[model samples]
Target: MTQFDAGTEFDRQVRTLIEKGFGELAGLSADAYADLLAPLRATVTDRAAGMEAPTEGRVPFVLVITRELAPIERAVPLLTLGGRKRKPGIIDRHYAEGDLVRFVPAKEVELPDARAYVLFDVDRGEEFCGAIPNDAMATIAGRGRTPLTMEEGIALVTQYPAALAKNKCFSLGGSRCGDRRVPAIWISENAPKLGWCWAGNPHTWLGMASAADRAGSLG
Candidate 1:
């Protein structure tokens, strides 16, 4: 697989956010938001410099803005199906953002404290397809990888809609609700939908998503 150019990917993410009006949501003008991300560009460039792009598997890195800056409610609606409008991503009515706090990162998955950060070597966990969520989590940990969080999941789909393929969708196993409900992103009504699945259950079409690590400065 050809590796994505880090700088180009970074620029694309910035443009996506601006075009999606994330700056306005953050209470800043588009120009101001771009300016805010300027410093991070240098950091990403430096980190990616001299690194060989992977020939297969995950991309180099993905830029992610936390819920504090880009709320999920707003970000989800921005997602489209195959670059066309189908149905906006919806958070199941049974839960709300306040309940999101209960879903913390799984063990070995450390997130950055900054409002924006980069998720390195993200995998949609295709290998774990057909595996139960609980079992999948163990397998991911055994592989010395970290599962993707809900924010990171949204970030991944936001940047790469192709990742949410029909039969190869993924679950955000990193964010556990202290119950059986594991958050997931899958195709529904020919659109991307954010919903929950029981941890004990398994779906042949869904695997757990993960990443190698994360990095960012406190911005």
Candidate 2:
């Protein structure tokens, strides 16, 4: 959790003085926090291996990032939870009771119960389509739930709407609707955890979390 003063360089790039929004974390001073974004970017070394960073300079990707209790991205949560059954257009997955799930920085926010979710799986399937669910709609308004690994969460989207069963053609590189690279709902909703500044793509009626915008609201 890094905090940059309003006129600092980081503030110009991020354009939000990140600390201004976090009034709840009064106990922690702004000087003590550091944004993990820079170091996380360094983690990717080989683009040929598919382990690469996004173009727009990691515009704050907030996905569910599910994984087993194991360390790093070794244990795909979905694979461990339910065999990686490659369906035609979706990738179904889950998060067990004690699965180890953590966002990038691991600072604030208590995390949801880590329910079974379904978002476009960027790996085996085509490019992720649809808008990812945002935090406002994804997370419960009041109490926070348990944490889930990224592996387990993607499964739900793979097997969504009972419509996937009808998807005859296998998506080689595009999402279900075709060409919608933006995920309709992303669990990878990265929260600033720097102190409660979470945002993302779209979301469902259940109000899921993501880096995308809001999908369908309860209203």
Candidate 3:
């Protein structure tokens, strides 16, 4: 029932990840360590707090996945409607392996092949890779104008049952926003309690602990 600051939660997660994964700096002076950590924290904190949704699909969420944990590549069951009969097809979407996935609005697509044809089947309500024989990029544009509210964000996470069922997301409770602690949750894949990571932010870099037990306490 209290307000909460997202940045604080983000800081704690970054610190924990560093400590657990990097261990104590054996040779560095205290000041040196402090110096080293300051920028790391600032860089990560700002990225999470200031993350913007993508501009293209305007997809309301971005799933930031850590590099250490590669996305689980499994085909999701997709029903494609055409030819007077619905056909079952499999589409590839990156699912988090074991780290919290940060959610941002869809701004652009980082396609594996820049020249590949993208397809959007309005009749089927599905988007997938296609052999359209054209270089035009297909996108699900014209959506996600309103900024997401806290409630709406939470709801967005619940929609991905596969991610949640795997315990890929977590919730944080009792963080001071302004004067009170509020309940907060991050439902992105492998999301830590704070829901952002340096591994996946800025650029996909390596060296971060996996999200196996990084759920953190409800506080």
Which candidate ranks first by TM-score, i.e. highest? 1
Tens digits of lDDT, candidate 1, 102-204: 7777666677754788887888888888999989998888888888888898888877777888788899998887788999988887778888899999999
TM-score of candidate 2 to 2 decimals = 0.22
Q: Could you estimate the TM-score for every candidate? A: 0.88, 0.22, 0.22
Name every residue pair that clashes in candidate 1. 1-55
Query: How well is each residue in 1-219 modelled by candidate 3, as lDDT tens digits?
Result: 333443454344334323322213224444444444343344333334433332221222222212222111111111122233333222212223432223322233222211111111101111211212011012212231122212222222222222221222222211112322122232222231223222112211111111111111111
- Cα RMSD (Å) per model? 2.7, 19.0, 19.1
Error of 2 at 132 (Å): 6.9
Candidate 2: tens digits of C-alpha lDDT, residues 131-206: 2323222332233322222332232222221212111111111111112221222222110000111134322222
Error of 3 at 112 (Å): 15
Q: Whole-model lDDT, candidate 3?
A: 0.24
